[model samples]
Target: MNDRSRDVRSIRLPRWGRVAADQGVVPWLVFDEEGKAVEPVRRFLIDFVARDNRVGSVRSYAFDLLRWWRWLRVVEVEWNRATSAEVRDFVLWLSGAVKPRSAPRTVSAATAGTINSITKKPYLDDRYKPRTIRHSNAVLRSFYDFWIELGGGPLVNPVPLARSDHRRPHAHHNPLEPYRAEGRLRYNPKVPRRRPRQMPDERWNELFAALRSNRDRAILALAVSNGARASELLGVRGVDLDWGDQLVRVVRKGTLAEQWLPASPEAFVWIRLYQEEGPPLDPTAPLWWTLRRRDHGAGLAYQPMNYEALRAVFRRANLLLGTNWSMHDLRHTAALRMARDEGLSLRDVQTILGHAHLSTTADIYLVEEESQVIRRVQDHLAELKKRAQLPPPPVALGYQASDLEVLFGGDQA
Candidate 1:
């Protein structure tokens, strides 16, 4: 046993390998040390794809499973032999382990996780966030559940639920009632609820003014006006625009359903200018195009603006404005303005935002801003002080101070 342990320690461990879509049978697959696909994992991924899961989801799950496989190799345990203790240890390791970064952090340790005065964004560090850990826990449980159901892997799921009782969760809850979450993973890290941060109008104007082109201005204007997600907006085609109705068709992010949302007149005006900036467009071509071009052995050709290109546009704007605003910030700004400033109903906001549930919209935008709440509370206290300074309500319709002093004891008065 000691010699075997030494052998395991001496041998360099193999890292995960990726198979591109062009080279693989499926869209993508992860290979083990011998350059062979882990059969069960491949099967699970095939089933995942069969269920109509997105390519992004497949990639994410593949990496997560690869991590699990690496952990199993280190512990000298077969994948099917893993128990709850293994899952617990895996989660604990993730919590304490420093995630490997491609490059060293630019910010100092002291500044890491602290909000920047200029950008108002936290300087992130090389640690796994609670959300990432939670996602890993979920992926493992699902993977194990798939194998266990087929009577191939462990008898019971290794990633056990936090709930002691194994009865059906929320079995008796009303369908229309707000969902009360239950049965999270035993070792899952708790994620804090973060309120959406909206960019103030002043900062929005600064960001707007910093944009160099009409295309960027139009994208920002449309986003802030309609709350379309960056990817969704980028996916918009020239034919999706309705000039007569002033509505733009966008594919909903979660459901992938198409929806038309109203845009501001100012946004439409910018869109017109942006369209005129380029030559006549094909109706089938993408709505947004890049200014710069890359030679593809033919000539410099402009490409459709993708999410990364859109991000770079904002990255330049952020440097100019010295604010760490994101594309999602525009969505939040539009949602908040529609919900609070425009006094729209939660249902209306949900429809426009393409949220599946009305409660989701209400939960995010219905809450009062912390600063606004504090200001209102301060005003209430000032009003109380003003009331206290009033001259005893005009002496109570002619009752004198002396009479009041006589009515009660002089010391009490």
Candidate 2:
């Protein structure tokens, strides 16, 4: 038999799974513990790519399907035989189980789920967040939907919608009203809403002092001033900068539309310094380049800065400051400052932040700080105490105290 046919015959559903990305036409594929490609999963992923979904999305779905396949192996259920019970059990397992650590732990387990003092954010532990479980449910539901339509897998979708009645989902829902939770997928975990944590000015200064180079400084300045996403900032090219206008052009995420955003004068100054110190730049070259070089076949050459490189810069600063700050934190800091400190309107902030909807910007940046609320509450309590300690007011100027008391009652108190 041919190699392709021979490989297919040797494939079997394994207890543990692996996700692999091919350098060929296929973006991603799943394999069993025995290193045999799961034909069903391969086909599904290929179809997903053909539908114009992102390659990153394909990778995410492949991992989710791999997890589902592993769970199926444990229960000795074939893919087509999986029921709602299997999906429910999978979510339950994810809820309680600690995620496997890819490397040795550096932080103590006691610190898990606690608020970090420096960053003012929660310390993440080795467990799947509720959002991840919900996403997995969605991936599984979509996967089964694709198969059922082709008449290859189970007749009905195993991952069913969370329905309140037998009626169709969203059958009579009002367009203006918020979507009800009953319309969501069954077995999906409820993800709690987390407010974005902005860095305090003092902590921001400390982080700035820890940066190793002017390139990182310029990056931080631009990010904190423009509220651009990390990826969008990294995508900037040398030609995209306008020194006269003090603006930088970035391609917006999701929309891919180019937008020119205003940046601080200090950011442009730092950019000039960084560019002066670094290698000579071509107008078409990437604005941000790595300091170090790696051999790319011919010889050692500097590469354009990517998300990972930008993250590493912050990682080093975080290490020095004893904080866990991400690149996105700068965007939060900028948005909060614009909305709260600078007295900018929500619409203005939304435009700068590149949010598709005004409500998104308002919901994230318009939240009252807990500390500010506590201070106001304390002041109110103090005022109430002062009023309570004051003596009774004197009788009206026109009437005697005894006469007023007799008119109302012996004791008006």
Candidate 3:
């Protein structure tokens, strides 16, 4: 048999159940007093996810555990008695082995380093970027957290393990820091930097024109007009719209807010046309559905479209417009237009955009036009000229002869 098969067969799971990792089959394993693999970790993981109200989270955790189990079997670690250190090592192995299929150009060096570090002590390399190390550490941390929570081992957070910066004897030293002086390393928390929000108006019009389908146009229009987030738009149902009031009930994050927005008559006409000709409509069904694909067999699915789909749409829009524009920029355009053209207050713009803070709304969505600035400068210059042209102030009232002589140069005036 092959090495993989040999490894799989050697695993001694308890009578409770054994999960078939090879086939994605999770079996319940029950262990006795003498540490033996009994049931599959899948049952426990599934139950845990269900209990935590995260059914979607189980598949990912299960996938991670399966790889961990395979490594443990190969390394001859007693699954029941696996120490925190062993769990840590297993996690490092998993992170490196999982290849990202999407971006083929990039290789996961951090993952490889993590695997090598756990398996062999002398494999440390100084060239690993801080960001890469942090990501590998996070994957390990998550795996250990799951392992501990399942009653398989003692509760130990692996974050500390991955985060610890201990130098190996043979490892190359960083130029910035000496090996002897390397201090306790704490993982830096990741922070997302905000990008400039608004795009040029010409690009916006071009994108709008490029949208081929009525549904696509309507989605973009509503998102731009109402300044709604992708999630809010995805969650929208047919019933959320009230034609009489010209309002839509939007759920932002978790809070529901009613927004008053007037749709153009043409836009309203398109929306009605979409309802009649678009995906089959149930009152409770998602307002947006996948554009029917022949390969997928043509019926509307209840779940709303994903973020990737929205991104693909935006990418297409950008290609057509000959400019890059993100979905958030649409909302920004709406806010800026309201502030500049509609003569709305900052607070009013904030309300329209559904921003939690007025400052954040202003900082991102408000655009300062060069023309407006130039106009203000010109007005200031005109005022100054008018003031300069006025007659000189009556020689300050009390004119003595000597003062008058000094003012008029040679003699008294």
Q: Listing every candidate in turn, what is its Cα RMSD in Å to the true structure after a full C-alpha superposition?
A: 5.4, 7.3, 14.8
Sort every candidate by lDDT, greatest first: 2, 1, 3
**lDDT values, one for every candidate:** 0.81, 0.83, 0.57
**Residues 13-131, model 1: lDDT tens digits:** 24556544525545777786677887888988888888888777888888888888888887778999888777776776777667665577653556666786864667567777889
Kindly list the per-residue Cα lDDT of model 3 for residues 340-379, writing each as its tens digit: 7566788887776777898887777565654457789999
Error of 3 at 199 (Å): 1.8
Model 2 poorest ten-residue lDDT run = 1-10
Candidate 2 Cα deviation (angstroms), residue 126: 0.6
Better of 2 and 3 by TM-score: 2
Question: Which whole-number lDDT from 0 to 100 does residue 129 have in model 3?
Answer: 41
lDDT of 2 by residue, 171-242 (tens): 788999996656688787777887876788898899999999999999999999989999899889999999
Model 3, residue 88: displacement in angstroms?
Answer: 9.5
